[model samples]
Target chain A: MAFFEAKNITKFFGGLAAVNGVNFRVEQGQTYGLIGPNGSGKTTIFNLINGYFPLTTGEIYFGGRKISGLKTYRICQEGIGRTFQVVKPLKRMTVLDNVVASAFLRTRSKREAVRLAEETIAFCGLTAHKDKLAKSLPIASRKRLEITRALATKPKLLLLDETAAGLNPSEVDEAIRLIRKINESGITIIIVEHIMKVIMTISDRILAINHGMVIAEGTPAEVASNHEVVAAYLGEDYDAQS
Target chain B: MKQYSGAILLLAVMLVFPLAVQDAYYQHLMILVLLWVAIGSGWNLISGYAGQVLFGAAAFFGVGAYTAALLSHKLGISAWWGLPLGAVITFALALPFGWVCFRLRGPYFALATLALNEIFRHIATIWESLTEGMVGILVMQTFVSKVPYYYIALGIAVASVLTVEIVVRSRWGYYFVSIREDQDAAESLGIDTLRYKSVALCLSSCMIGLAGALYTNYMGFIDPRVVFSLHDVSIAAILVGIIGGVGTVSGPAVGAFIMVAVMEIFRSGGFGFLGKLSSATGSPFVATLTKYISEAHVLSFGLLVIFVILYLPNGVVGDWPILKKKLLFWRRQATV
Candidate 1:
């Protein structure tokens, strides 16, 4: 049985559909990759699934329980944690505190929260920068902080939204390592990323979306070879070049 | 060690203040300082830490004061009951006010609070049958000695400051700051932004309301203009936050003392010291100087605010490092 499922999910902003008639599911402890061009409803699907935006139509189920239209925080309490494409760290807070805030959602004790935050910071390789304010960190570290904070929530299903958008090759590689470690911990992940290397390397299965609908869904190699996926995003000539 | 020492010394001074200062006028100024400390600390919690800049704290303050006054006027309840009752009433006001207003973020929410302040003021002034209108209510003071009021006010100040300190160091403080930094981020992380914001607002309104109740008990008078005045209650609260340090626990305490001192200096023309100096000299120049200083106190206060904004945007406690460095440099130059 699927651990998380979005069935025929649709979202309309005014009259236009931002996301339309999409269905996807993540098995327990699986890494699911969502790939799409700009404004193709990839993020919208994540938003809909995470309960950040109410679906205009269709239902989302987590372990057979319907979760559509639940408040974002309520969904989070049900064990879904998400990161933004644009990182939003508490500027006035230390990096440790950024994670501590999220940790408090699961634990009422400040000591436990701090301990969890510190452990997550170390896991994300941010222990050295723990005392530094979040706003002072460079983008690479800020991205790590975003992921660290999400990890602090101890979610069963984690959503990564463009987590590797603007990173150097080494930084992207580091993020991939962190992501794989996260997946190995028995937490399911759905990653929306523009980086092909990161997507192809870690994704057990890939879903390609375009114009608010799914174009292809399969194993990484299978989806990479799909004609519609090539035409929509991978480019028709990409096969010839290889 | 230095931080702990300064706080202990201040507490010691406050404990023996009424004893040391035999002058009733001086004792009154200290009482005002304590009252402002409670109000300022309340303002600091929601605005400085929570990032909800309230423009109408007077709404809750007035509610608390009126709650106390009405209890005495209508039910003949001991005015002291108003202290706790005011906190409850103000919390009631904040629940819906925060629910409706938290939807509007940043400055718009602030404006909503300001509007609430004005609305409360108008209600208090116009509700003749219930509030006795602008004519106000008069309560008998329980104590004429000023010592009881002084201690009670001091206790309130300490309690408020301690509450703010504890909240800022707790999980709620983190949630409040997170909401202020980015509500969307906070929500994404599973923080109920609205709930935490409501918590911060409730805490603030409750403290201010208690202060309001205390005011009525101490002064033996209640009027819409005095308790709910925009300039006195709301702006004064904001000014206290700015002057002390918006986000820090110690900022409001420092700010309250400074604000009260400055206000008294201007209001009483240097605690009537200027009047004595003018009379002693009896010179036209001295008398003219004294007249200008007393009459221009408000102008001077306005100028001081401008100076504070331009030079010390972070407030005295927040900018103490820079101030210390400057002071050290000046001392070195003087010795040279």
Candidate 2:
């Protein structure tokens, strides 16, 4: 049984298929990458897997249990944690409280929740700003807070959507390091990133999609070398450039 | 220590207030202020902390008041028992009302609550068989003295404040705040936004309802207009919440005092201070001005709300720091 699988997932927004008939599986502990052009339904697929939206024509399973119909929060309790493409922090709350609220999902004790929040915040290099308001944090910290908040939920499978989107080179490198650490901690990671450096360096296997359909699925090098993936990204001049 | 001292002082003052001041009118004002505290605290729970922007506080309050009135009129039960019973009946009103209205967010929810206030008022008025129509149900006062009633109101007000403080400190409070900040983010993080919202509404409604029951017992009279009034009950509740500091626990207590004082002062021509001045001066103009001011009390209340919105938008407690800074800056300029 797959650790996570989306079978024949399709979604429509008034006769337009935002995501169509996409099926994929993630093995336990696998670091999977998803890449596509803008508006190619990358985040839409993330939303479906996490149960943010009901699947129009498919089923999603976690540990072989059908989960496509569950609410987003229920899926989180079932051990699937996710970060938003656009970071959503509890703005008025302290950064520590933001993580503690999610950590409460697993533990009933406030002390335990606090412990988990502090540990996760420290891991994200946010210890110094623990008491600061989430809104007052810088963008890089806000993005990291989103990931840390998701991590505190203690999920078996983690979905990170554009976690490294707006960072500079140094911050992106740091984000890549943090993501690798998360992946190595025995959690299955499915990441959606437009940063080529991030996608190429982190993913053990990469899946390329165009118009919500998988165009190529293989090792990072294999997916990068595929003609369809290249054409979708660089246009017909890709072969001419080579 | 400093944080608790003010509360302790307030507790001491309230405990000795009735004994210190034997004036029935002053005691009556205190009871009204305390009742507003309970109602405003409830309103703050949903509208302020939970971010629901409720406009139908009277719905819960009226339901609670009617529950007490009905229990006595129909079942021959003590109106005192209606205190707890009122909350239970309010839950009946809130469960369905929250389930329906929480589905609508922002200003739409506000409009829905206003509509509900009207609906409840009409139901109480038109359901003459059970409610006894416009004649209104009258309950006998349990005591001839105002002291016992003041203490009862104080106890409930204290209970409500403690409840709010505890809830705000607990995990449920955080959930309410998260829903307020961003419902989508809250849901994605595994919080049931609707369920938490309903929980907030239930707490708020029951508290407001409890206040209504207390009001019926104290006033010994009930009418749809008096209990379910849009301006007097609903808007007054909102004003208390906002003036006290919408998101803070202690805010409504302070706000309640200011609100009552304003209402009383304007309604009685500065509590008859203006009347004294007018007569002492022996001027027709001063006498006429005093009468007009008393007559325009409601307008004065409206103008006060407008100023609070323009200047202290976050209320006294929430914007205390800004208020302090402005004050200090002016003082510094004077010193220079």
Best by TM-score: 2
The DockQ scores of all candidates, in the order shown, are 0.83, 0.76
* Model 1 misplaced stretches (Cα beyond 4 Å): A234-242, B1-3, B281-286
Candidate 2 CAPRI assessment class: medium
Instruction: Tell me the TM-score of each prediction against the true structure.
Output: 0.96, 0.97
Q: Write the per-residue lDDT of candidate 2 for residues B1-336, one digit (tens) a residue.
A: 897898999899999999999999999999999999999999999988999988999999999998888889899999988899999989878988888878898999999999999999999999999998788999888899999999999999999999999998788888898888888888888888888999999999989999999999999999999999999999999999888788999889988998999988999998899999999999999999999999998898889888888899999888889989999999999999
Query: For candidate 2, lDDT tens digit of each residue in A1-242?
Result: 98888889999988989898998999999999999999999999999988888889988889989998998889998999999989999998999999998888888788899999999999888899999999999989999999999999998889999999989999999999999999889989999999999999999898888898888999999998999889899987975687
TM-score of 1: 0.96
Report how far residue B296 has shifted in candidate 1, in Å: 3.1
Best by lDDT: 2
Error of 1 at B168 (Å): 1.4
